[model samples]
Every structure is written in structure tokens, then in C-alpha cells.
Target: MVGQWSGREARALREAKRMSIREFAAHLGVHERLVSKWEAGGDRVHPRPVNQAALDTCLARSDDIERTRFAALAAPEPDSGPRPDAGRSAAPGGYSNDAELLALIDTGAARGEGLAAISEKDLIMAAAHEASEHAGRAEGTNIGPSTLDQLDADITRIANDYVHTPPMPMMVEMLRVRRRVYRLLEGHQRPSDTSHLYLLAGSLSGLLANASTDLGYLDAAGEQIRASWAYAEISGHNGLRAWARGMHALIEYWSERPHRALQLAQNGLQYADSATAAVRLHNIEARIWSKIGSTADTERAIHAAADASSAAAADSLHDEVGGVFGFSDAKASYYAGATYIHLGLAEPALAATERTIELYRTGPARQRSYGAESLARVDSAAAHLINGSLDGAEAALLPVLALDEDKRIAQLEERLTGVRRRICAPAFRGVAEARALDERIEEFCGSTATRSLPPGSG
Candidate 1:
């Protein structure tokens, strides 16, 4: 009784069917060594074209074996010849065959087995190839808005998932998938088609912008954001346009162009009349005001942001913008904490940071891991600075100082600078440690500040 077929069972099933390894290999038009490897477990066979074909052949033989066994069980005469019903159906509903193979693969993946063992990479590559082929077959034809919308959702999911995961070797391949999708949209020439195409383009641009930011390609991020803004505008997607503008403002802020950041944030507000995008727009505004030292504007924007966030929580009417936007209460709290930090309200900032950290920690491991480490560091630094514990501040920020100069994290660097400048007087007492940290921060900031985007580009 074959209860369950491991790779060994698969091989045994093939042998029981009188199919020699070399014969089977020849049948599949493969080298004999490959069959031996599959049988001996020398390598875990992925369900590629040849492997799948071999599996199918083996499964057919397994059905024959199972039928013979069942017929033998039913027969009264021990000397009966091969039963007619033998090999009728080896696996029930094909579940024990193809479905079981897939289940085994999925189980291995769930258990944290490497993709090398299961050929997960090959499966993904094959799917991508098929998608590309389909796209090619549909070339020079206009796909529906619904099709584009679904593609948008798919691409967004892929990008969002990969953002926190270790960069896969397939990153370039996935980006090509996105590029093809964008090319499809660009091929449509109808003026009436502009809105959907523009929306798709904006979404694609945003994904690329984020990828570039993660890889520390600040120039590429800036370019992608500009392209995103253009598409958002052309689509009449004011909310998305505002969102894109906010991204541009963020890039400016990161590049140390505070004035340009403020202007871009203000431009984002021009499209913030929509109830749904209001919170995001105000958040961007608050950050810009913090950069420019506009205490009054910053406070106003914070209040506005809080109100808009409350509206989102209340499930108020949202705009018809066809994408994910805004945040939940916990994410809003994180932004509020960040704003308070900028306003020099250190105690409240610390409290908000604590809440935000707690919330994210309780949610997903990926979410906890991404910014939580740095946020914890910055929060400790800010807390120590507020309490006049310069030594504690130095201890907290010294580790992060050794990180690669990431322009996207200019806010963190700026905060570190403030802490250093505040403590340079009596706390240092001419200690070499204090002097060294100060000089290192100054050098980092000097280089980052010099590389900022030129003003008036926004």
C-alpha cells in the first residue's frame, strides 16, 4: 500500500511500471544522469518542463499500479491475469498526484526551506515568462480599463511585498514586468484613454521611485517622482497628484532643500480638498513647515493632519481615487510623533514614538523590523537630549552615525546634528569622544547638504 509517495516512492512507482531509468530518460528526451539524480535524491527536482513531464508519466504508471493492487484485493482467484480495471485511476481526483506535488512544494516554502530546494524561483520565472508572452500576443491592441486596474493592483502588491523583504535576484526581472505593463499603456493612443493610462503610469512611477529610494539611488527617485507627478496631473487624479507632489516634497526635504520642500508641500495642498487625501497632504505640509522653522504653520498643519486622520478613522466619505492611500490610527500616531519631535516637544514625541513602536511590534514582524530599529535609536537620542543627558544622547546616536549616508534619512541626520550642537558646550568638557562624534556628524551633513537638489525645480 503506497500511503504517500516521497521522491523515493515516485522512483519506485516508475520502476514498478517496468520503466528503466534510462528508458524513462530517453522517453522524456533527457540524459540518463538526470533521471538517476532525480531517483537517488542527489538533487531535489523542481517541477520544470522535463521534471513535470516525468512526473506525469510516473503518475500514470502509479495509477496502473494502484488499479492492479485494488483488483488483486477484489479477486477470489489468485492466478487471475492482469485485471481490466487495473490502472483505471491510480490517484483519486488527481489530488494525490499534481495537487499533492504542489502542496508539498508549498509546505516546504511555509517551513522556511530555501527556494533552491523547491525551485520556487523557476516557478516565478516561468509565470513571468507566460505573462510576457500573453502581453506580446495582445500587443498593438487596447486592453480595457479594468484590465489595467487589475495590473496596477498586482504590480503594487509585488512592489509593497518586496520592499521589506531581502532584495531578490529576480528584482530586475520583476521590474521588467512593470516596464512591460507601462509600455502597454503607452501604446494606447486614444485621448479618452488618457486617464487610465496616466493612472497606471503614476502607479508604476511610484513603485520605481520607491525601489530607487531603497537602493540609495536618490537621483533616480527624484526623476521617477517627477514622472509620477506629471502622470497624476494628466489623469485629473488630483488626490494622486497631491500624493505625488508630497513624494516630491519628501525628496526635497531629504536632499536638504527646505525651501523647495515647503513649496512642493504647499502645491500638494492645492489638491488636498478631497476628504480622503487630506490627511496625507497635511502630513506633508507639517513636515515641510518643520524644515522651514515655521512654528505657526507647522502647528496648524499638525492640527489639520490630526483632524483629517480622525476623519479617516471615522470611515468618512473617500474620493474616487483608485489606489491605496492614507493611514490607520497607529500610522497616524507615528507621523504625529515625528511632527512633535520636529516641534521640539520632546516628551510628547517620545510618548508617541513609544505608542507607534508598540503598535507596529504587535502587528507584523516585517513592519516591526523596517524602521523600528532606527526609530528606537532616534527616540532615545531625542529623549536624552531633552533631559540634558548628553552622554546618553551620544551613546544612543553613535551607532547610527556609522551607517551609510542615506539621503532618504536626512531627517534622522538632522536630528542627530541638533543633539550634537545642543551638547557641544559643557557636556563635552573637551572630551575627544564628543569632539569626534560632532566632527563626524558635521562631515556627513556637509556632504549631504552639498548634494541637495537645486531650488525652483519643484
Candidate 2:
């Protein structure tokens, strides 16, 4: 049952496996560049014979039409329709890999002269230095005061837009801006200006770290936080330092390293006086305490957060960025409700959740974070289930279930998991509504809407 083969065919197989190029390459014991070449060549290119066998065996289990077609292509003596000379047309690799080019030069110069008499090597070295100088001059154009202001404004806009947008897409934009800011750092600038740039980088990394977390890449998020902390340290900005530490603590918390989370919170609190980071660090401490089931510690931390909130209001200093930095009544209530849920305080959790929803709906339109609100709804539903109000629980979660597939994030899914567990409790086992709820949730979970990401999601 051999069928046609093409680049489109190869691409479909790779995507069906849900692998990055590097992952696919690793799976096939091939280089990433080679895979790219294969895809670029379309019908003319195919995996080497042995590799074709591996692709067939590995992908045969998939029921998808695309993968099924891919299986056919992998079969012996497949028909490759009108082959295009894509490999010849493709440009050579760029000079981005300095080490590889240098290695080539080294191998070429390994003559009896012992590397001193290689004219070609000298020419390449000179050319590389000239190219670097040219790039440096081009980057220098970005070092003016006005350019710095533009960068600052751009970062602020991206940060402000973060709460309303999906993290997977914003992460790419953050990385792009971060790369541009890094380029600017290589140019000539005053020490103060350089420090300002570092602060901006720290803020961007903070946003990226949060985005990584939202997309369920906690390990990647942790590395981004480490980079953010370094940038904050170099800038010597107390607010940035505090924010970075709080973010670091949150990563540790999510990773289930509670002791490290508490330690990071304490470190952040040292810089917390008269800053909005004060409110954030205090709230983080309360969250850690709740995780450990320490009622007294949680209460003390919650009280400190309230005091910090009031002091922060008087100080007039605020986060230059948005997304993860700002602290508000709605945000505080949401955190408290989540903490209460961790502490098994059903009544207080419900109350805080109610306040969260009310404030989000009635407060400033700019302050509305739909992702946070969705989680709050899940919390409210879980609280209802705790009280044995099955119908109330189901009703509270209807809006969450109704969300557009793209709008459902990892946090919302995790929150819904708690509801699912509650629905299966002995009290609700015989309930028809409980079964219906489970079925509806299962259907939603199995949908392609949850699986099909938009372009550039990586």
C-alpha cells in the first residue's frame, strides 16, 4: 500500500508526533539540520532506508489520516511525485555558528607549518573581525537616550498586555524583545544607562518566566527566573530584586520545594519595605505557610500582607511593568482564596472567591484578568463541592467549561482537576448529575480545541 512522499508528508509526520525538530532528530539519530533539509526537499527527499523502516514502525500506531499517509510514504518503493531540486536551491548555512567555521579552518590549517602559514585562515579571521566591527557600529545606533525611552515604553506595553493574552504567543515576543535589548547592551552607553537596560531585561525575563510557567514548562521557567535574578542583581534595583526573588519562590513552590520557596520569600522580604514587592512577598509567604498546613504562620503572613498593602499605597512607588508584579484587592483576594483552599478552609475560601469575582467584575476594566477569574471560578466550584452542594458546584463551573478552547490555560485545567476529584466522592457517586458532569468534562478534555495551538505557539 505504498503512497506518495513529499516535504508536506514529512512535516505532517513530524507534527503528528508533536515533536520539536531537535526532538525528532534525537528520535531518529539524525541531525536537526538534516531533518530541515529533508522537509525542504519535499518529494525528492526521504529518510535513508533504515531510518524509513524506523519511521514506519514508530508511526504506524497513529490513527490520524496524515500519519497514515506518512506510514504509506515510509513503505518500501514509495512513489515520490515530481521531485524538486530543493537541496541544490537551499542556501548554505549562515555564519552564526562561529565554532563550526573555526573548526573547519583549524582542520584546513593542520599542515606542516603548524597553523602559522595558512593564508586562508588569516583572511577569514580578518573578515570575521571586520564583520563584528560593522555589527557593533550598527548596534551603536540603538544606544541613544531616546532609543532607551522607546525600549522602556515597548516593554511596559508588552507587560501590560500580558494578563489579557495567551502566554505561549507572548513568550516569543518577549524573547524577541529580550534579544534586541541584549544587542543594545553591546553598544556604548553610560553606566547608568547600562544599568537601566539591565533592569528592563530583568523585567522581560520575569514576564517570560511567568509565561513559561503558564505553558506548563516549569523547569524552563525556573531557568528564566535564574537569569532574571542575575539581571536584577546587576541592576541593583531593590524593587526588581524583590520581584525576581518572589518569582523564584513561586517556581520553587510549584515545583514542590516548599522549604526553598519559603527561603526565597524571606530573601525577598528583606527588600520589601515601602514597595509593592512588599505586598507580593508577603502574599507569597502566606501561600507557602498554607502549603505546609501552618494555620498560625498563614495567619501571621496574611496580616503582614495587609499591612504591606497599606504601606505600599502610601509610598507611591509601583511596578513599572504589569502582569506578575502588581498587587491589588482583586489579586490579593484571589491569592487568599487559593491559600484558603490549600488550608482546607472551605468557608473562607468561598468567601474570598466571591470577593474576587465581585471585584474583578466591578473594578477597573484594565484590572480584569480573565485567566485569574477562571481559576477563581474553579475554586468557588470546589468550595461548593466541599459543602456537598453538587448543583451549585456544577453551576459555578459552567462558564469555565464554556470558555473558548484557546482561552483555557494550564492553571485553569489544573483547577478543574480538583473539581473532578470532588465529583467522584462517595456522596456523589450515585448522583446522575455527577456522571453527566464527568462526561461533559471528559468530552471537553478530549477535544482537538485543547490540542490544536495557533501558529507560532512555540
Which regions of candidate 1 fall more than 4 Å away from where they truly are? 1-150, 166-174, 186-194, 214-217, 273-276, 312-326, 366-369, 390-425, 430-458
**Tens-digit lDDT string for candidate 1 (1-458):** 43333345445444555455555577667776655555434124443555665655655655666556533532343456853323323232221222223333434532443333434443455456547754654453466647766765565555445423432222454467667666766554455565766676676676566555544467888999898888887887776677777778777777779788878877877776565467766777786787677889988987887676555322211233222243434555666666776777778777776677577658765344333344456666776677766677667666556554432243455566666666676756687876776787677666442244356422
Every candidate's CA RMSD:
19.1, 16.2
Q: What is the lDDT of residue 49 in candidate 2?
A: 69
Compared with the true structure, what per-residue lDDT tens digits does model 2 show for residues 265-381? 999887765547787788889989999899999999999888776663322123546555677778889989889988888899999999999999997676688778878888998
The lDDT of each candidate is: 0.58, 0.73
> Which RMSD does model 2 reach against the true structure?
16.2
Candidate 2 is scored at a TM of 0.67
Model 2 segments more than 4 A misplaced: 1-142, 312-318, 446-450, 454-458
User: Global CA lDDT of candidate 2, please?
Assistant: 0.73
**For this target, which candidate reaches the highest lDDT against the unseen true structure?**
2
Query: How displaced is residue 18 in candidate 2, in Å?
Result: 50
